[model samples]
Target: MGERGRFLLPKRKKRRHRTAVKMVLAGILLCALLLGAEHRMRPMIETVAAYQARLLATRNINDAVLDIVQEENVQYNNIVNVRQGIEGQVTSLTTDMVTMNRLKAQVTNRVSEYLEKQTMQEVKIPVGTLIGGSVFSGRGPLVEFRLFPAGYVETDLYNDFQPAGINQTLHRIMMTVKVRVVGVIPFYSVTADVNTSICLAQTVIVGKAPSSYTDIEGGVSPFISQYDYGLQAREKLPQEE
Candidate 1:
């Protein structure tokens, strides 16, 4: 009976030791599962962040284009108003044309100055031009405006109209602004041109007009004579006009 009891005791202790080892192993596995979750979750978070960044970059570039267009419109409005006011105040019939000519010079100078000011501004790309990873995943190949003045001038003449009065003269003021655009992309770049023109027509009844008023947006009947000095970077109106 004593020998039998000794044998049973050894077997029981051995079983307890094995059970403890298994419990320790189970605890280790649970801890491992919690810590390893970071490996899977971190990558997903990074990918989402990258995608959001790409979307923001796209929006910024679009906004940049809009900002440039708005700036050009404001400058043009200013030129037209200032020129009209200056000429409208003139009392001499001869001075009307002379004032308009002077106004052209001022417009040219204004455009030149605007281009010069823009040169000081650097076009910004909100996202770093290049993203890492495969080609499809990366953001690169961007376009930013580097507008430089090609030239600007006032042109067009209309002398076919009858004089309405002794002092009042009708005329059209045409302003053209030409700018160059550079497409900055990774590993390659290209340049393009954009041309925009603004037309201001004035007809004073009981006054004299050099001719009729014509515009890029077509004339108000009775064709007007137009001439200009500047790069016609945009689609030229059909010569028939």
Candidate 2:
């Protein structure tokens, strides 16, 4: 009876050790699968999340600009002042500091509010889609993820003047917004930074175009008139006796 009991005890011990080894191997395999899935899904996840965030952010910014424009009755003249010389040439273009600043603040506040209101909205993507093969794409269960502001929404209001046609310069009031968004999945999350610009208002100025222009958006002027080039060339030429 004692010898039989001893043999049974060793058999039980071996079985338990075997079970533990199997469990450890199973755990390692599971971890490897998860890691591989994560790597494979990263690009798809980022693309989807960024697209959703950009769409939402664009809509919010447009809505905010539209609301402010309607509420404040903004116009080209209200935001910009153009000075003309005796020959009806555009000499200087100046922005109304008070109006511009006020509008900028209002836009920033409204965008922030809109983003906050939209943070709860979620985007649904299928697991099969993340797998990203011709056979498995878009064929599996859906996963829910949401976008929220990762940081403060940045808003910039500025002016852009471009030549529209001969002797015509188009003055545009532009707004650029930068939003950092995060997508939260079940156990994974991704972040993206989206930058977008919209034209709030524009007007065609009918006169001689300016030689150079400057704005808060850029230090160097984007528009250089041919008239200025001609003058510079003439000044550099040797004087006739």
Candidate 3:
């Protein structure tokens, strides 16, 4: 080989090495940019997705409760037995386990079916929102993502007594539903617990009201009959003799 050829060989090798280093650095820079973009965008997407999941869960639960109650034509007197004294004074309240159990099962199954069929949803977020620019917010190329929600349903049947008038008591039979929704995105996921209560039936008892009885919104006292149905577990109300 000539001197010129030998000298050019090392120069070419050095240029190739420099090019390879530049290519690697460019690749690393691209990856960093992508990661940073994901970091900034993930929270916004997750927030939207979580809100959607919670909304979905709540709506389904409410629909299920309403459908079951209306379909079965349940009434306050059907599920509760109120005992009164000779003078028509309230003695105690009892829950009919059979009716309550059936209602709970129906509600749970309906809600589960609804959730299973409706868990997957699509959400489109504008790129500008992730950029956090007010001027361009909600105005950019839409980034679409799918949220797959998976979870379980728990139902509770309880009662609330509130004073209606001087001698009137307002008894409300309420059903509470809890749904655990885990929203899964491409590389991220969020969980949300949604709780909702609906009144199945209500009736005013015409008798002496309990002086210690207060509104249920504050909290339930130990004396009240509160049945929490956790997949068939029942809190037995004292059966009247």
Candidate 4:
């Protein structure tokens, strides 16, 4: 009986040892599953945080780009307005210049016409004439008064006169003259004075005489004949007679 008891005790001891080993292995497997789950959850959490940070940075960049575009548009509008104003001012100045040029041309034309009309009415005349004469009467020739287009006198005629004729009794004469422009509507008039002096005389006679008076030389008396009878007789009588 003692030997049977000893073999049963040894078998019991072996069964207790096997049960203890199985309990320890089950505890180790459970700890390994929990650790793996924790490790995987930590990586997922880090990835999500990184994505959120990228989104925030992208939003800020987009906002800054939008602000720059808005500022550029405003500056462009200002430039366009300024250019339009300058163009308008230039147009106004050009219009004024054209008007001034047209007015100047009209004034120049009128002045030219006036000067041409004045130049046409100049005249010249001989130095002797008779007009309602008393002896030593006021009469003379017409002289041209000349002026250039600039209204300055161009001739020296106002300072001198030329003699026109020679005869003692007919020397002094009065003149009345008119100067007319050809193809012009109105005429101009000018007047002057003249004087005469006789240098020689052949005879002097006074009083009247009878028509029948005769001289000893067989010629008619001087008083009884006409003053120009000597010249008339020479003309009428033939040379041989």
The numbered model that scores best in TM-score is 3
What TM-score would every model get versus the actual structure?
Answer: 0.28, 0.76, 0.80, 0.20
By summed lDDT, the worst window of 10 consecutive residues in model 4 runs over: 152-161
Query: Which residue pairs in candidate 3 have backbone atoms (N, alpha carbon, C) closer than 3 angstroms, thus clashing?
Result: none
> Each candidate: RMSD to true structure?
16.6, 7.7, 5.9, 58.3
lDDT of 2 by residue, 30-56 (tens): 999999998998788778877777777
Of the pair 2 and 3, which is ahead by TM-score?
3
lDDT per residue (tens digit) for residues 32-130 in model 1: 986675453344334343333334333333333344435444322342232222444422222234444544455545544444443322233312232
lDDT (Cα, 0-100) at 171 in candidate 1: 39
RMSD (Cα, Å) of candidate 2? 7.7
Alpha-carbon shift of residue 16 in model 4 (angstroms): 1.5
The all-Cα superposition gives candidate 4 an RMSD in Å to the true structure of: 58.3
**CA lDDT, every model vs. true structure:** 0.39, 0.72, 0.79, 0.31
Candidate 4 structure quality by residue, lDDT tens digits, 1-241 = 9999998998998999888888888888888876775464333333333333233323322333234335333222222111113323211001122322332343334333443544332323222212222442334764333322222111100001122322111111111111121222122122211111111112111122223432233465545444432322333322220
**Clashes in each model (backbone N, CA, C under 3 Å)?**
13, 0, 0, 2
Name the better of 2 and 3 by lDDT. 3
lDDT top scorer:
3
Please give the lDDT score at residue 88 for candidate 3.
Answer: 73
What TM-score should be assigned to candidate 1?
A: 0.28
